[model samples]
Target: MTNSLKNLTSILLLLFLAPIVIATIQTPLVTQTQLPEEKKKEETPIVYAAQLESSPIATEITEPKKAFVYFTHYQEAYQPILAAKGEKVAVYHPESNITTFQEQINAQFAFHQVETEFLENYNKQEIKEYNTIRPFVLNALGHNKYDIILDIHRDSMKADVTTLKVGEESYAKFIFVIGGEHENYRWNEQLANNLSDQLNKLVPGISRGVLVKSGKGVDGVYNQDLAKNLLVVELGGVDNNEQEINRSIAILAKAISNMFFQPIAS
Candidate 1:
């Protein structure tokens, strides 16, 4: 070969070799920079919605049972019924007493009997707890072989509208708000209907109605399918006192207890 042709070939070889060395040297640095971007992704926030059976933990609890539970107090929707009728606003005050059942309701209401009992039994201690209700629910399921989870809460609305007379006694009306998307959705409705009917007879106007929320929302399902019987019941509004709420609790608890434990009609 001629000298000029050999030189041209050498130049071509150098050009190709230079890019490979440069890329090889830079590869480790490029990978190091990616770590921060990955860490940032880890910190990104996530929005939770229903029909979420994706997590590895989701498939662990699947069985049959009734769970009674309560949410940590998250709002001031119920303020009037907290303190005396004419007294100052202790609405946001710490709930020191009134555990198990509301005073009036405990005098009457009982929780539904179930294999999976979800009652926090905080007994009016505090409502705004964190991730406190369900861990116990899981444990209760373990202890008693329970399957469903029901967390109870009161509705928030104007007091004058909520307070009404039932026979000679005072009672607050309630609406059974059930999430519309759970597998047990229909059964939940049936439970609500049965309870509503029974309460209507036991304490009229205590049931506002059964509200089914089918749209996208957090409460449409309160982790009901740990078993198919899970449900959350919003008994009374905040304007109604624990005492007035108790009137409805009696029949409410009985309805729940009976449904959970009784034999299904054939």
Candidate 2:
């Protein structure tokens, strides 16, 4: 009686314990299989947060500064270039004039990521030409804001006064002419001084210096009274060829960019 009872009890105990042991092992296996999926869910927000942090970089892009360039004495031409074209004039030409510098200026400014707007139209009447261009300049200033306004011109002087040699290259020298008659002329003078300093720093002696004109028979205001940022730039004399002038333009554009834009990291 005792043996039969012992065997039956042992068999029943084994059947019950077998199911419990199998259930415990299978539960751990299910958890192990699901761990990767659970970890992926937990890490989803971190990946999304990284993308959000980087998204603002696209929107943080800065716009370039703007410059307005216009020619008051647009008919002023280089003698060497005009002579090559069979023109007899030493300083003045109806076409092939100082206004042609606008192309090189625009290209150099673009390379530095500075935007330039040039106004080249003007009347043929050399007398009171600044008066004729004033309305157009005022109109341009009204429509758009400019960091600087340049009235590009050519000097009537000889090449000795307007050309500079830096290292081995010859550069057409420039001078900043600001009228001192106006009430706010000092501001224009300061701007000219800053630009002249930058130019000379880039290419030693490239800038002849800032000239202030205010007296009778000198067009004392030179239309600079209209804006604090306006000034006349005597680019070169009649003798400087296109190559020298173009090199100077590149230096000037770089100076302008250095003044207005953020410095690039080394």
Candidate 3:
């Protein structure tokens, strides 16, 4: 048993065992490679394409919300004097006709069938002036949550100015009035602009455009502070008759329905 013979024997044994150790270490790597695709997918932290597509955060846009319509000035009727022929007589118009705009909106359209609630607190003497309608409006807002609140009114504009010809019949062109007094006035303006855009699409000249108002000579806020999408819509002029108003109402209902309930394509 010489020293060199002993050292050579030890080196050979070490080489033989090294291969075995390496093979043993490689066993787990082979097992992992041979694992099922499903099991591999489960163990991996990466999200799959299908899962990414179906995620709630990555979903499509939602449908528009329901709207509520009410008139603050319930007795604000169209003045008949403005409808008279000749040089468009601008006489002292003071007669308040009995027919209610609230009834007209409810009757002319199928709004009752849809997700629409109309506030009908009608009395000529009670909510007489524009200023007197705040409490009523505030009360309405307090009770219900609405995505849109339309303060429907007949404008003082002349018929010739407000009238718009759609197809065969004539429609009283409307204006979207957004109040600038609220903190979320931009949201209100955006909604008004969106509605105006939608209306103008159906009838080119139907919408007079969005009018943002604040300060003196106006109610300023117009109770628009209550909701983000509240709007004051002037339906037609003092001269526009019930027939014209009804036609405008029908068009409005169609436009609103499309804007809100219209489904997004999957």
Candidate 4:
């Protein structure tokens, strides 16, 4: 055979073999035996929003830091929640109903002086209660020398997907909502931003998102008053089971503990 013919034949042979050779080169299969030791995490329990205490990590994070939390709940249906969670209620007058008592009541708020340094330092404390949010906060602030005032409320939303999952159980997720329509809009949004960021980071998708609500129903403008570092947290909604809501709080306690003690910004 001519040298040119031999060269052409060799080239053709190489081209044909290339396809077969390429087929064998593949990523090593990650077989069952080769899989990592980490087991798949269990799904979170799906339960009611009102019963958010299913997660036990709740109290581990709350360290009596001159903080006061006020909930805008109807007097008739909230005591059980208060008792189960080991939360204290500073009712103005035990004889009178909280929701029915229209007159504004005030109290001083604070933690023990030794631990007072952990409390927030308010630049101003001129609280006015012409609306819903203020009265509840004023009452709490009256009794404790608290720099941080949190106005709490329950949410109401359809729960097709709002159901939050964390470490083998599903619970109603808490949404930190702020209303931009109010005067202290930026500060309010910042607090909500901090909370939502932490919850979603530690347990992805547990936060519904920061809502800038406007209009009448979202009343209290949402208590963005009292101080710059106010928190308005919506525990859970009607669609969420009570247990789920409780667990969300438990997760929240961990987040709160981190915010106060571990300043590693979520």
lDDT of 4 by residue, 182-215 (tens): 6878887887787687677566778887878788
Model 3's alpha-carbon lDDT is 0.66
CA lDDT of every candidate:
0.54, 0.78, 0.66, 0.53
Task: Compose the digit string of candidate 2's lDDT tens values, residues 45-66.
Answer: 2110111111111222156778
Which 10 successive residues of model 1 have the least lDDT summed?
48-57
Number of the top-ranking candidate, with TM-score as the measure: 2
Ranking by lDDT: 2, 3, 1, 4
Instruction: Enumerate clash totals for all models, in the order shown.
Output: 27, 0, 0, 35
Model 4 TM-score is 0.55
Best by lDDT: 2
Better of 1 and 2 by lDDT: 2
| Tens-digit lDDT track of model 3 for 122-163 | 553676555677677778788888766788877778878999
Model with the higher lDDT, candidate 2 or 3: 2
- Candidate achieving higher TM-score, 2 or 4: 2
